[model samples]
Target: MSPAHSVLHAVFGYAQFRGPQEAIIEHVAAGGDALVLMPTGGGKSLCYQVPAIVRQRAGQGVAIVVSPLIALMHDQVGALHEAGVEAAFLNSTLDWQQTLDVERRLARGDITLLYAAPERVVTERFLGLLDDLHARGQLSLFAIDEAHCVSQWGHDFRPEYRQLTVLHQRYAGVPRIALTATADGLTRADIATGLQLQDARQFVSSFDRPNIRYRIEEKKQPLEQLLRFIEREHAGDAGVVYCQSRKRVEELAQGLQDAGVNALPYHAGLPADMRQQHQDRFLREDGVVMVATIAFGMGIDKPDVRFVAHVDMPKNIEGYYQETGRAGRDGLPADAWMVYGLQDVVNQRRMIEGGDAAEEFKAVLRGKLDALLALAEATDCRRVRLLRYFGEESKPCGNCDNCLNPPAVWDGTDAARKLLSTIYRIQQQDAGLTFGLGHLMDVVRGQETDKVRQFGHQQLSTFGLGAPYSEAQLRAVARQLLALGAIGVQRVTTEAGHAFDTLTLTAASRPVLRGEQAVLLREATAQARGKKTRRAGALPVAAADLGPDAQVRFINLKAWRAEVARAHNLPAYVIFHDATLAAIAQQHPQSIAELEGINGMGTKKLEAYGADVLRVVGL
Candidate 1:
């Protein structure tokens, strides 16, 4: 049998490889490099892990994994140890004694996987030690996690990642694999070039995350909306509530706790130990919610997270996708709820324009935001829109709000054109969203608002033409334009009442007809009405649905899993995935022999729990 398959069975207790895992492992085990792009939760780890174990068995050497997040390193090492793999990590969080102990283990060739962040990896001390290990044939492979960070244009760009090429040049014989969950075509190309993977095999999995249900809501009373969403959708489940501001994160966490939800706040502003403790609790305890800014939740791997809600719009869709991808890793139903508003668009724009990101990057970021706004304002299936964005063609999912209950959509095509023209004029004059709104009204109704007269916008022929619609209606039209990428928000404000907090339009705006454009502004409004449209209710299903039989089974399984998990402090799935339970239910295996027939259960699992599983099922 292949060494890779043998370890997959003995250690991971899986009877088979998932998707391209086996092929990728084979390639690396045979001394070839690879660049892998798999969706979040799509078993990216196995691509490197299985090969690392197999290569080690061949007496090659230890694998060094470069990870970006320290938290992820801890989690991965814990998981590997639970599976009987000797893994260690070096990071700032490690004490000198602990670091020295790990180095000793590495020198003795006892560790299979050693994780280090890119920044610490090329240090003078580390490089010298790594050279010593290489001389003794103790350096097997190099795996870079979150490879997208190497691309400056990527959302999570890190300067340290750019220097990772040092490992490739210095350790030319070590096969390498770079892994990430999200990246566009451009970012992927950049990573390949930066990492010097000119001859490496590239594995690009479908970017679609079918398990995540994408959702966006127009911002109203955001706090109240978030509260209602939590109460209705997640009665007894763990989740992450994200806010753009540290203050908002703290307030929301406090409010959630007051509302009877188990929640804690985490942000960069918190004392280091406080943040760490909160993170630990959230990781170890069930139903502990975390309220955090984008500062938290990069490489968290909690599988049963029931949902992710955004109190404010993220900077771009990449950030949104990566954050919401944290939910439902257990392959169960999970919600991605977000509340967006005009102010959110302005705030996001302010952040983007204020940053040092390049103009090209900013343009791309703006396009991504516009797409998100379109998803939020979509009157059709939310899932459809989201999948389409990732370059997938799918029918309505029939699960999201827009599918079960679509919103009223008004045409407002002419109104849309007029709004774009107003924004364009404002852009030409170097004004922002706040001023654009006033300028638009002046052109639509011939209204002589003082600013309009001073700006001489009232003289425009499009002026007074859209007077038929209310100011609110005009703003809605403008929003759709921005969402659709017809106009870009030029400036933004975050200090509580400046105009430009949300989205701005770019060059994608459709040109307006000066004489003919006025003709369309007066047309009938298109209504995107909600179908079933009742506000979301408390947990879609009652806890009582966990029937007596199911409850007993679930309890026994959870207890068994919990005991194993706590013994090693690794997440339960690292021991036996939940998918095994559903399979057990369907088969109701009556004996050790029967349990062995289950898809994921291997000889190791059979020998360990074969009798217990049979007895629990009343066989």
Candidate 2:
């Protein structure tokens, strides 16, 4: 057998490689550079890891892995140790003495894989160590994880990542591999250019995460809706709830806690220790629902997260895809749930226009935001649209909300024209004074509210033109117009110094107002009705489809595994994934020998836990 295949079985316990892993590994192991794009939970680590072991065994020496997060480095090194691999991480988590010990090991060629952050890898002291290793022919390879961070177009860009090109400049002979889970065409090009991997073999896998069910809802009583979703569908399940603001994260976390859900808040504003403690609980314990801002969940490796809910719209599809991809990493059924409204569009736009970025950068951001809006307002398959954003074509998934219960659409051309006309006439009559949605709706529907009367909008020619439409319907139309850039929002401060959003016409407004472009909108009431029929109840467990006796065995095995995990202070999956436990339970292995061929049961893990697994199965 080839060395890579041998290590795959004896060390990692996998019978075969999945997708493009084998090819990537063979190419890299033969001293070839590669850029790999694979989805999360697609066995990305193995592409670099197996080769690292193979080359190390050949006396080439230690592989240096550049990672971004300390938690990820710790978990990876711990898992490697469990697999009987000599791995160590150098990061701030280590004291001076501990750092010295790891450096000494590297010098002695005692470590097979050394993981460090980009900031540390670029330091002069670390370069000196690499120089010595290169002189001794001990630097085997360099694996850059989360490689998208090097591209400015990527969702999570780090300036430090740009400096990583030095790896290619200095170690011209050592093979290098850069990997990321999410990147569009632009981001991919930027990554290639920024890393100087223009000629490296590129491996792009399917971006589809089929296990996740995409569902987007129109926002109305968002917190209540989110609570009901959790209570009804995901009770006692580990999930993530993303918000756009720190205050909202805190509030939602407290609200979920008050409602008897085990929820915690995480954001960059919290004390470092507290953040780490919360992260530890989320990783080590079960049934934790983490409510966080965008600051959380970049390099987290928790594999059993069942749902990812967004209380506010993300600025772009890339961020949304990356955040939602965190769920269902174990390939079980999960949900990507979100609720957005007209204000979400306004808020996201205001952020883009209000930022300190250059005009060119802002334009790129606006284009990205527009793509996300299109996905949000899409009437067809959410999965198809999501994949298309990454330049991949796909048929209807038949699993997203649209395919399961297709939303009804309506010809909103006249309504959109009327809405735009109302804004125009009101602005012209009132000397360009702007109004928020409430007052705009009041004037459009001829409500004769106190504010409408005060503004004398009741006399406007366009007033009452949209009397046939409900407020929700008009809001949907307005949202579409804003998304289309036919309308823009202006932040106007009142005499009391309170700022509020007001609608204004844009260059794109002329076509709609002049009867040149037709507007199509999803029926708001139909969307609300469709939500009632969405799948509800607990997420499917690994052993859900097993026979009754096998199910019991699965439960017992899980109990045993949890105890062992606590003893080791590692995530339960680090010991054995749920799929492995289910397989053992289903097969009902009679002896340690019978457990030999089960996936994920490497030689070291089998030697350590094989008898215990058989005992649990017999129980």
Candidate 3:
């Protein structure tokens, strides 16, 4: 067997490589640079890890891994330690003495792999260490994780990542591999140029995460709908709910807690120690539903997260895909659920236009947002549309909400035109006067409310023009018009400092207003709700398939794992994944030797926990 293959089985405990992993590993190990675009949970770490081990054992020396987050580095190093590999990380979490000890170990050639942040990797002190290592021919490889951060077009761009090109210029002899889970064609080109990897062998894997069921709904009583979704489908399951702001994160977390869910809040506004503690709890404990803003999830390695819900629309499709990809890292069935409304579109657009970015940059951001809006308002499969955003074509995934419960489409051309005309006439009658959705809907539907009569909008020709349509139907039209750029949102502030969104017509409105373009919308009906529920007493591992006795064994193994994790002060998955424990339970391995060939049972883990696992299974 090849060195990479041997390392895969003996150290990482996987018998076979998935997708392009083996090829990427071999190419990089042979001293070739590469840019790898693989999906989440696609064994991305192994593409560089096996090569690092092989080169280190061949006396090439330690590999340097550029990571972004401190929690990620800590978890990766801890997992490597569990696998009996010598790995260390240099971050602020380590005090001066501990940092000194790690540097000494690196100098002594006792470490195989080292991880550090991009900012630290470019520092003069770290470069000095790299210089010494290079002088001795002790630098094996350079692996840049989350390489998309190097590109301004990427969802999570960091200025520090642009400095990483120095690695290529300084260490010309070392092979480099850049990896990211989420990137489109534009972002990919930027990464190649930014990192000076234009000629690197590119390995682009399929971006489909079939295990996740994508669901997007129209926002109506969003808090109540979110609560019902949790209680019905994901009760007692680990998940993440993302909001658009820190205030919403805190409020939603409290609401979930009040409803008896084990939920926690995480955002950048919190104290550093508090955020760290909350993240640690989410990772270490079970049934934790983290309600967070965009700051929370970027390198979380938790494997058993069953769902990722979006309470508000993301700024772009890339951000949405990256966040939703956080669920089902174990390749189990999970859900990517979201609810958006007309206001979501307005808020996202307003933020883009309100930014101080150059017009060209804002235009690109608007384009990205339009793509996300298309995904949200899609009538076909959500997975297909999501994949298309990344320049990938895919068949209809039967797991998505659209595929499971197809919503009927209706012609909203008339409704859209009426909504647009009302906004125009209202502005014409009273220059610079704009109305929000509530007043506009009331005026269009011919409801002579106090605000309607006070503004004298009852005499407008567009009044009662949309009286035939229901409020739900007209709201749907308004959302589609906003998404299509036929209308725009202008933020208005009252004398009392109250802010509200007002509708305005854009150039794109001319075509729809003249009936030259048709507007199609999904019919808002109860039949559109996608129903997914867990079996009453089933475990995460398909209790019906496991049978009663295996279910009991799985539960026992989990209890034992929790105890062991607490003793070690590490996340439970760091010890052994749920899949590994499920395999042990189902196969009923009687001897430690029988557990040897299991997927996650490497030499170190099998030697350490195999006997105890057997005892838990009543062997």
Candidate 4:
């Protein structure tokens, strides 16, 4: 048998490889390089991990994995050890003595996978260790996880990753594999260019996470909306609540906690220990609700996370996808719910324009944000639009908010053109000076505010042309224009030393204004009729619908899992994932022989826990 398949069964406790994992492992194990673009929970780790173990078992050398997330490193190493794989990690969490011991193990060829943070790597001392290993012919491979971090255009770009180019330079002959969960075509190309992996065989997996149910709501009492979602759909389940600001994170966490939800806050503003503890508890315990900024959740691998709720809009689609991808890792039913308002759009625009990034980077960021806004305002199936962003096509998912309860949409083509024309008209009226959305909307809605009169925008022909719509309607129109990329916001400072936004028309706007493009906006009235088109008490759990016998079996298996987890001091899902338990309960595997045929049950796991699982199934 191939060593890779042997390890896959004996160690990971899996019967087979998913998708391209086996092929990628074979290629990389044969000393070839690969670039893998798989979605979250798509068994990416196996591609490198199986090869790492295979090469080590073959007496080649130890594999060095460069990771960006320290917390994730800890979790992965623990899981590997449970699988009887020799794995260790080097990061700040380890003391000097512990670090020394890990290095010793790696050098002695006792460790199959040695995980290190990118910053810990590329150091002189680490390089020296690698050099020693290379001299001893004990270096198996170099694996760069989260390879998108190397791309400066990526949302989670880490400068430390750019220096990873040193790996190729130093270990010229070593086979390397780089993997990431989310990256667009441009970001993918940039990842290849930055990591110098342009020649590596690119294995791009489908970006579809079919298990997650996507839903977006226009913000109306966002906290209450989030509460309704949590209480009505996912109460007592593991979930993540993403906010846009540290302050908002704290407030929402406290609010959720006060509302009887087991919520906690995590952000860069909190003490390091506090942040770490919060993350640990969220990982190790069930029923935890983590309210955090984008600072959290890069490589979190908790498989049973039931939902991910965004209290505010993420800056871009990449960020949104990465954040939402954290849910439903167990491939069970999960929800990706979000509530975004006009303020969220404006705030994101200000952040993009007022930030310190280069023009090229900002331009890329704008495209991503615009795409996200389009998704938010989409009248069709959200899944189709989201997949299209990643260059994939599919039929309506029929499970997303749009599919189940379609939002009312209005033709905003004329409103969009008016908004874009207002920007162009203001530019002409003020000798190329432009105003922000507020001023432009004020003039369009015919609100003779002080800024409008002072700027003489009231005199423009476009002024008062949009008087048919109310102020709120005008605001909605402006947001749709920005979302559609018809209008863009820019940073501007006036002579009086006041900082404000300047509106600009995009290339996408010209066609819309010339009566060549159609625009659809979610009707503003939908927010008022929220949750009315559908009848729902709670989001349906995937396994909740099992028949009475299977249901009882599932409960019994879950109870056994809990007892085992408590005794082992591990998370319940870690002992056996929900999906695995569901399979066992449904099939009623009454003996070790029958259980051995289960997908997630490995030889080691079956030998250790198979009897217990069978007993729970009434053997």
Stretches of candidate 3 off by over 4 Å are: 492-500, 527-538, 542-544
Model 3 per-residue lDDT at 29: 94
How does candidate 3 score on lDDT?
0.92
Quick one: ranking by TM-score, best first? 3, 2, 4, 1
Residue-level lDDT of model 2, residues 1-619, one tens digit each, is 9999999999999999999999999999999999999998888999999999999999999999999999899889989989999999999989999999999999999999999999999999999999999999999999999999999888899999999999899999999999999999989999999999999999999999999999999999878988988877788888999999999999999999999888999999999999999999999887899999988998888988989999999989989999999999999989999999999999988787777899999889989999999999999999999999998999999999989888889998999999999888888888546687788888888899888888788899988989999889999998999899998877777798977777888999999999999899988753333233223333237777788898889888888988998899898889988898889888999987789899999999999998888888887
Candidate 4 least-lDDT 10 residues: 531-540
Question: Which candidate number maximizes TM-score?
Answer: 3
- All candidates in order of lDDT, best leading: 3, 2, 4, 1
Backbone-clash count (model 3): 0
Query: Please, what are the lDDT tens digits per residue for candidate 1 over residues 153-174?
Result: 6778898898989988999988
Error of 4 at 95 (Å): 1.4
Report every candidate's CA lDDT: 0.75, 0.91, 0.92, 0.84
Q: Name the better of 1 and 2 by lDDT.
A: 2
- lDDT (10s digit) by residue, model 4, range 1-619: 7898888887877878899898899999999999999999999988999999889888889999999888878778877766778899999978999989988887788888999988978999999999999888889999999998998878888999999999899989989999999999999999999989989999988889999999888787988888878776677888999998899999999899899888999999999999988988897776799999988998888887889999899888888898999999878878899988888887898898888989988888888888998888888999999889889999999999889877777777777777788788878767546566778778777889999889877887887888877676667777787777677777777788877768788787888999798876666655323332212222225456677898788878877887877787666666777777888878887678888877778776887788778777893
Q: Candidate 4: misplaced stretches above 4 Å? A: 413-442, 447-465, 494-497, 502-519, 525-542, 547-553, 566-569, 614-619
Report per-prediction Cα RMSD to one decimal.
Answer: 4.9, 2.3, 1.8, 3.3
What is candidate 1's local distance difference test score?
0.75
Q: Candidate 2: worst 10 consecutive residues by lDDT?
A: 530-539
Runs in model 2 lying further than 4 Å from the true structure: 492-500, 526-540
